[model samples]
Target: MRPNREDWAAALAAADKGRVAALADRIRDRAQVDLLAPPREGLMLMQLRESVAGAAFHLGEIPMARVHLRLTAPEGVAEGGAALMSDDLALVTRLAILDAALVADLPEAPEIEALLAEGMAARAETQARRALSLDRTKVDFQLLSEEDE
Candidate 1:
């Protein structure tokens, strides 16, 4: 995916909690942050469809966590938000902080970029491995002809 603001946000959200925390630590030391909305658990409805133009259906409800936060730095103030598919409060908080930091153009932006690259690489590897395994199970068959007497 193209490396843009939204991309960074997604990357941060997809990253491991430990990795997000470690990346956020790089900016937390020098930035002032405020949590406008504390991380909280919630539920969101999931949707699915059988085909591109197929009718949609409600799959089920999934756990979610979200937070809205702001960061103040020498450069300026930046607002951020985080919504997760899981109810990981800490991870959402970290992602929100990182989002604000990236928006604020903190010195740690480069590090966050690196982390994004690493996450993208890992995801690609996982997808490749899964595809390879799936390819092995592909089935092929042909129609047989009956003998004529």
Candidate 2:
């Protein structure tokens, strides 16, 4: 299944970087892309919420890159934007292009969807490995009372 708009960014971020770049480059070569806003690179204030107190606090600053652009392809035209926690402006710009292509339902949409699936699968595999590692170190504590009984 294709990822929804809300999940599109995450899927793109998680997918293989080389593959994503290739697809983005292909779309870019055939389309007229106009940057709606100059590609930006800066630090974003990281925020976090405390689970216990339900309070929000600024964690720290994280390097971030953002891109907003419009793509005009033969099939359609669409605008796309991407903000990611990295200082790679080119990568972010490429992501924005892919976002536009997918939204435009350009001929490359299926390829984009395939990239998303590959990324999601890789993310799931990484999570599973982490869980297994955690489980290996898990310690079950026995109460003193129970031990005596």
Candidate 3:
């Protein structure tokens, strides 16, 4: 089945630093890209809400990095951007390039699709491992039965 936009986005977001960089490098080698906004690091407020419709609250600020890139593709000019929670400037730059390549539908799109699949699989494995750890700690109330005289 073909992956949707959300799946592709989640894959890129979940990818590790090394994988993102490598993919970005591959895209750069094949296309002409311009840095619309050079990598910039800043602090952004982490907002939280009890629910989707609940009131929001600030959970303090965290370091964030972002980059914007534009590339010339066969179709036209494609703009791509990426923002990350960490302060890794290089990683954000690479992600931006990858995003642009995806938007441009370059020849390397299939490679990117493969990368996304790999990233999503890795994320699923991590989540399964975490779930297993949590399951181990589950408290079974049936085991706590008590008899009183």
Candidate 4:
């Protein structure tokens, strides 16, 4: 039998924490005694960014599906792009959930919807930093950092 929306949501939540922990472990291991040579920290940072991106890629579509299955939002897709936590798909998911929560008949929707905007700004910033760290263009973050006046 097919599971319900609640089941989907539950499954998503259950896996999220594990995925995050695993990603962190992978980054730490790669950074510490794993990847030798210079630029170890940057390598680890890239790995961590990848981990985050991968998680969002997998779990990002979930929140949108939850909205769709519940028929909370008007039947429509959303916009997306190469954003941090807000991958195009992830952004769509967030928008779907936000729209649904805003108009849904459920009482708990408000609280759940609040998370749509939460961390989005932070995610973008984090992703930008990660991308910069991985830049092979020789961008000097130290110089950039010092120039901020």
Candidate 5:
């Protein structure tokens, strides 16, 4: 089925955004203060909105036919088991993450650097997850959501 542009945009936005109000609540519970810290925590309001806008742009909702540029295969190469490991597809996926991370934090260099680091780790994890899925060998996947797991 063809992807709906609005649902794609909303999914990308929800995946990309944190519940800032909930984060503020957690901070208040942990360390409440009369004058809270400057806007160093979440992305600035405009930046957060721009992220959603950027996602829409990425999905080709801007000035072009909407097409899903996926990472699972490469052009000029036939689709097969090992197509995902091709250098071109890998590079494109990596650059996409880097591009997204570059704009993840706006008007803050340290946050950008931090986002880059997170981006690298996330990219690595995605590759690993993709490989695991491609393996198609079933396992009793225990859901351990922790760095130490």
Candidate 6:
């Protein structure tokens, strides 16, 4: 199944860094990229809510990077932006370029989609492993009346 655009940034961020860099470089070589604003790196507050009270509170600060840029290829021009909870500005910038390239339907869009698929698969595998580990530790509690029966 095709991934939704809303999931692109997270999938791209989790993709192989070397492949991402190579693809972004190739796109840059063929397209004109203009940064809408200087790439940014800073901390963002992490928020969480209590399940019972449904009250929100600051979890902590996380390092983040964001990029906004426009890509102009022969096919068309497109804009993309990425904000990720990571300190790597270059990676975030590359992800933004890839996002715009996909939006513009550049020749490299297929490769970008492949990378996204690989990333999503890897993420799913990791989640499955974690779930198995949790399941191993699961405890079943039985009430005294049920146990007596």
**Best candidate (score: lDDT):** 6
lDDT of 6 by residue, 1-149 (tens): 65988788889877898999999998889889999998999999999998999999999999999999999999889998888888999999999999999988888889999999998988888889999999999876676568889
Candidate 1 TM-score to native:
0.76
Q: TM-score winner among the candidates?
A: 6
Q: Among all windows of ten consecutive residues in candidate 5, which has the lowest summed lDDT?
A: 74-83
Q: For candidate 1, write residues 40-74 as lDDT tens digits.
A: 88888898996867989999999988889888988
TM-score of each: 0.76, 0.84, 0.73, 0.26, 0.24, 0.88
Question: lDDT, candidate 1, residue 44?
Answer: 87
For 1-149, candidate 4 gives per-residue lDDT tens digits of: 22333332332232333433343233223322221112111111122224554542222222122123222223322221111222234333333333333334334343433332333434456679898888857767899889995
State each model's C-alpha RMSD to the native. Answer: 4.1, 2.8, 4.0, 18.6, 22.1, 2.4
Q: Name the better of 2 and 5 by TM-score.
A: 2
Model 4: lowest-lDDT 10 consecutive positions: 35-44
Report, for every candidate in turn, its global Cα lDDT versus the true structure.
0.76, 0.89, 0.76, 0.33, 0.30, 0.91
Error of 5 at 37 (Å): 35
lDDT of 2 by residue, 17-90 (tens): 99899899999999999999988899989999989998999999999998999999999999998888888888
Candidate 3 per-residue C-alpha lDDT over 62-134 given as tens digits, one digit per residue, 9 for 90 to 100: 9999888898866556888878787877777777777778777877777777778777888798899999999
Q: Which pairs clash inside model 4?
A: 80-88, 81-88
Candidate 5 versus the native: TM-score?
Answer: 0.24
Give the C-alpha miss distance for residue 134 in model 4, angstroms: 3.8
Q: Cα lDDT for residue 139, model 4?
A: 69
Model 5 over residues 29-53: C-alpha lDDT tens digits? 4331222122112211121224654
Model 2 weakest lDDT span, ten residues long: 138-147
